[model samples]
Target: MKKKLLVFLLIGVLVFSMAGCGNNAEKPKSDIKVAMVTDEGGVHDQSFNQSAWEGLKKAEKDFGIKVSYVESQQDADFAPNFETLLDAGNDLIWGIGYKLSDALLDAATNNPDQLYAIVDFSYGDKTPDNVVGVVFKAEQSSFLVGYIAGKMTETNKVGFVGGTAGDVIWGFDYGFQAGVQYAAKELGKEIEILNQYAESFSDVSKGKAIATQMYQQGADIIFHASGDTGNGVIEAAKEQDKWAIGVDRDQNYLAPDNVLTSAMKRVDVGVYNVVKDLVEDNFPGGQTVVYGLEEGAVGIAPTSDKHVPKEILEEVKELEKKIIDGEIEVPYNEETFKEFMKTL
Candidate 1:
């Protein structure tokens, strides 16, 4: 009887342990796995790549989905990194930059069933049925900052450092120049702008050298649309006790006193919305999503340094409203920019 009782108790403990194990086992994996492929800038670029990654992280938390990313060190890495993510069972893959257009297009064409998205590029009539292109009105926000830079310049000379000479970056350049020209007309002051392209987003030394030369040439404020290279621009500004404008993200936190403001491009919002749509089964494929000031996806960062006058800030706010209301048309390219300059 004693042996039987002991055996029965052991069996009961064993069954309970088995039940607990079954209950604690991880739930079946989430069906929706999303992944991102970063451009040569890498994920911590503190600009474009960082913003996109933040969106992926948000989707992972909000939807209980699986997410991953691969950082491409150079142009050659794009296709392989994309394929790796797909092979790893990602339901959606995002390429974060205009440079990835060809690779992404090829991949989407070959794998017609896989969903893909690319930032800063649009195929227009050639858009694939399974791909969505995300673009931004970067010029609109750059114009705002350019106006501020014009008003704040002590020397009446400002500078712009662009990462690359492309339609996307050109939008920033033209909008900035137009804004400066408008501000010059308003203030009845002669403003000069010195513009240069670093030709590389990752070359910090090149950015710093270009900015330093501009500053030496009497430019009191400089704006950079370079990626990680902008870091060097900010450093040069701080060292020289000058002002700098940032791009893509609000970078005033980097040097609150030195950074006048940032031209904001809400890349994170774009990425988040794309993933949310995918998860919710309403993915808007075969279309280009253009986010602009009206959509609150682009704007100028708040002036946190107290260098910009209250009246000037108010004026900028009014201009923002005008742009959003379609009362003010910001130029997006060189030709329109020149025409806009003529009007000013």
Candidate 2:
């Protein structure tokens, strides 16, 4: 009877120990799925789409959210890809370019329960309650880099190659031109800007052709906002031993010797913030969030070489402060650009 009692007590202790261990074990994390649909530039464009994807990847790491993406090969693919993501049970979906604005709106309308965010788009008063618009004051940063190109160029001729003539792309174009003009005036020099649009974000050959032509026309540095197409411009700059400025990402590594700097748009931050908000139940829908130099959403990448002088960088920083302080207004459209040109 004594031995039986001892065995029974041991069994009870074992059961209690197992119960305590079970109570102390970590609970399984709830699944929060987030997905993105890239624009025509796709994820590997090393530009806007790539930046958005980087933000999604970061969210997955930090928040333990399941993340996936669908690449849009053309304009027609946008809506379909959004559907694919929705069908796959994504709790939050993002469209990663201004081109996806309409598609995102349509999707948001049809799927009112799902949360959506779009980068580089402004819906103004038309924003849906289920959608969030993320835009950047790219012109503000483009101006700074344009100043860099203006001050660094020995030929007094700079060039801009753009992917499209849309409003968002035009922001980069107008801002850069304005910055160049501002720098030229400050330096007491006359500079001519050669600008053109390739009309497509993925046409590498066309971008290269445009850059080569500009360089041949005595342009010492070419700034391209042509997405993957800008990759071609970089190659042309390398081949001709000229300088190339990248857009949206720090492309110095693309051709470290030839790339002077890059006009950066913090798409990653925008995407990450929207996703974080959704995760935290504080999503700011039915609104447009504009990030600018003041918000550290746009700027120029660090110069990879000694081509840009320290004084020029310092001057650019001063200009950045002025813009952020509202002492200087960067042009973001054709009308504003024309007005800005008058000041120059």
Q: Per-residue CA lDDT of candidate 2, range 1-344, in tens?
A: 99999999999999999988976663222478889998777899989889989998898888888899999889999999999999998888999888888899999999999999888888899999999899999998899889888888999999999998999999999999999999899889999999999999999999999999999999999999989999999999999999999999999989989999899999999998888887777889899998999788899886633567777777878998999898888999999998887876
lDDT of 1 by residue, 9-82 (tens): 99999999998997666333366899999988888988899989998999888888898899998899999999
Local distance difference test scores for all models: 0.90, 0.90
Q: Any idea what lDDT model 1 has?
A: 0.90
Q: What is the Å distance of residue 219 in model 2 from its true position?
A: 0.6
- What is the overall TM-score of model 2 with all chains considered together? 0.90
- TM-score, per-candidate, Cα-based: 0.90, 0.90
Clashes of each: 0, 0
User: Which 10 consecutive positions of candidate 2 have the poorest summed lDDT?
Assistant: 22-31
